[model samples]
Target: MKLETIDQVAVIGSGTMGSQIAMVCAIAGYRVVLNDIEESSLEKAKESLEGHMERWIKKERLTEQQVAEAFGRIVYSTFLNDLKDSDLVIEAVVEKLDVKRDIFEKLDQLLPEHAILATNSSTIVSSKIADATFRPVKVCNIHFFNPALVMELVEVVQGPHTSDETAQTAFQFVESIGKLPVLLKKEISGFVANRILGKLMDEALFLYENGYASHEEIDLVVTKALKHPIGPFALMDLTGLDVNYYVRQQRYEESGNEADRPAKTVEEKVNKGELGRKTGKGFYSYT
Candidate 1:
């Protein structure tokens, strides 16, 4: 298959990653359609996108006019049926194989034969979702970091059946959008960054479980001494304890190990809706 320039990009799921990915595509001059299942979700996504753009203007990273133009290139829709015109559809929904496969199967029916299908799944294997699509050759992973615009690296993971040309097109397009693309030849559990991050978190959880130190003390030691941006507990809070647990659980299920399990404290807190800084609570209090 010949590599085609992505003219219309659809970001399925208007959550944080999806909205940010849509914003980046718009800023890079691609027409972006953000698809979600709820009007409220679209509203939240639009607010999130506008807030980020306002920050750019406030910080002088973008002229007001430029921000306006960028915003103009994006639209929001609640219908999956509207994805018929997309040149590329990226699924950034929750990291669940069943949900992702369902979306991919629907997208395979929606898009044309030449259109590309990608997922923003951070942990699940590309092949798992690929098998659910009729056009498995076009299915690949374009995993962007948390904040898509600021972060340069995008993990371009190709499934076994993914065509080389299709994978290359995805990589080049990601680079065109001002991102550094890392190509993984085959599927690996947790890809790369998540694996490294998970191992570190596991050790930290083990230490805390053993009463090696208090949360605040451990955080202080890591941040002040190791010069990390923040300690593990603080980072977990920022990521939302629930979100972190989901990622860890994905790895644990794949590896079939108890060690990869999410910390009990994290899971209990998440179950109680005591998420993180966004909620003004977590390992530490924001107020």
Candidate 2:
């Protein structure tokens, strides 16, 4: 389908990324269907989105009426079939290949043949999941950073199977939503931004875990010395440690390299359900 043809958008999984992505599309004047398996999750997502929009109003980034109209454009649903009319579907579910492929396969069957399927995965490439759908040409990675509503840069990966039209449509759609789109001619495991950030995070974890310095000290050094807006550890917490753990796990499984394995601390926190801001604790405590 052409860029102009994309009207209604669907986002699967009503977690943080999914909710924010749906809001982004809604704010851009597209009717959005945000779907999850649980009605409770959908309700929670709506509540969270309202809170976010309220903050935007307070910050004067958006007016109350604009927020209301954006919210009105979004339809929260528990049924996958509700997405039948969506011209594009962005899957923001868990960072597991199996789960993503399952969603893509289902979306392939539910959505119209012309619908484009994109993943908001930060690590996994779209090609790995595109094969699950019959329309690999319409599949591409539209990786949005954490807090999709706030972040401006979006990485659009045009995999081998992705058609020029599909990649251009995704790029234009991202820009149409007011986000800057950087096109990757080829697909890599982490795309561009994350690959560089991942190395920094790896080193930070190594230093902290090896007793070179506390996470707090390392964060201070990065923020003060490197002049980064947020330190690696803090950023990981914001992004969710579970996401980092899963990403590392996926890498280890792919490379069979011990160094690519999730850090022990990250694994422990994920096992204990302390997944950063959402859970109130991760590398640091939010509560």
Candidate 3:
């Protein structure tokens, strides 16, 4: 189907990335269905979207009328069957292969034949989940950066079974929503950004663990010397330590490499339920 044919979009999970993605589609004038099994999470998504709209209005990035219209276009639902008419379904659920595969299988059975299935996973590739559905040609990875409403760069990854037309259509869809789209020629574990980020994080952890410097010092050096926007530890806190831990665990499970395991500090934080900004504590205290 052509990009113009996509009128209804659905985002599953309603978490940080999912909710922001739904709002982004809504602002772009598409009917959006933001789905989550829990009503509390859906309420949180609605509150987050309202806060984003209010901030944009105050900054003059969006008018009050535009925000109102966008809000009106979004529908919250707990039923996966509600996505039956969605022209595009983006899965932003937990970063687990089995869970993602199950969701894809269900979505494939529910959505129209022409509906495109996309995953917003940072590490898991579409190839790993595409086989779970019969419409492998319609499945591809459309990885959006964290804070989806603000981040401009999106990676559209083509799996082994994904059709060329599907990748092109997904790329066009990303552009249609006012985001920069980069094509991944082949499917890889972390796509592009996360792979590079993984290396940086590994080195940063090594430095802190080996007594080269404290995390704070390392972050200061990266920010002041390299002119990076945020230090590695601070970024981890924003992204969630629990998320980093799970991604690393998945990588280790896939490769069976000890080096791919999560850092000790990350594990420690997750064990304590510090889980970064969401929990108000991680490498740094948000409170």
Candidate 4:
């Protein structure tokens, strides 16, 4: 499977990151299948893609013709068998190891032997799920940041069994899509960006929990003083409290470290269904 032969991509999941990733691949002229378990989720993904394309056209980043072409390249499906012809499959489902492994196992049985399998998970490494498939050499992590269409950096991770050819091909694939690619020589739990961001978030949560400062004040200082575009709380809202909580829970489960537990505030917000901007409320109200 040469890079030139990789024209069909399958993105499994229609949530925020998955939808954006599908659009990105389509915009790069690949025929993309965006798969989800529910019809409503696929509809939402199509709507979101339409809005993103419209915004891009309005901003003159993409022409009407380009948007139309990209839109025409995407096919939404609820079945995993629909991805049988894909040359590459990027999984962007929830951050659970079992769920991801289940999907990978199914994909391995369905996709062609040459197809490459990648995950968009931030914390869960590829090695953890590669064993679910017979072709562990083809399994790697291609971590895309939130708002995948907007973010420039993508991490192409190599697991213990990931072959050099797979890593090189994944790197080239990401670069061909007009995004910067950074290779992770070894698989780390959080990779590079999240590890640093996790430290910052941990300290921020600690400060707020210990009553050393208010969440708003801490966020203000980070934005105004540290020159960050958004505060930690605001970022959490954008990323979703549920997402944060779940990722933390997974980390805690793996490490058995008390500090890896989700922050109380985040857990409470997720419990109340105030996920983030998508739900209209989190640390701050969007409604």
Pairs clashing within candidate 1: none
Runs in model 3 with CA error above 4 Å? Answer: none
TM-score of 1: 0.94
* Cand. 4 TM to true fold: 0.98
Task: Tell me the deviation in Å of residue 245 in model 3.
Answer: 1.1
lDDT of 1 by residue, 199-258 (tens): 777778778889998888888888999898778899888767877878777778878888
Per-model TM against the reference: 0.94, 0.98, 0.98, 0.98
Angstrom error of the Cα, residue 233, model 3: value is: 0.8
Q: Superposing all C-alpha atoms, what RMSD in Å does each candidate have to the true structure?
A: 1.7, 0.9, 0.9, 0.9
What lDDT is reached at residue 142 by model 3? Answer: 94
Per-residue error (Å), model 2, residue 152: 0.4
| lDDT over C-alpha atoms for residue 30 of model 2 | 97
Worst 10 residues of 3 by lDDT: 237-246
Residue-wise C-alpha lDDT for candidate 4, range 98-117, written one tens digit per residue: 99999999999999999999
The per-candidate count of clashes, in order, stands at 0, 0, 0, 0
> Where does model 4 exceed 4 Å of error?
none
Better of 1 and 4 by lDDT: 4
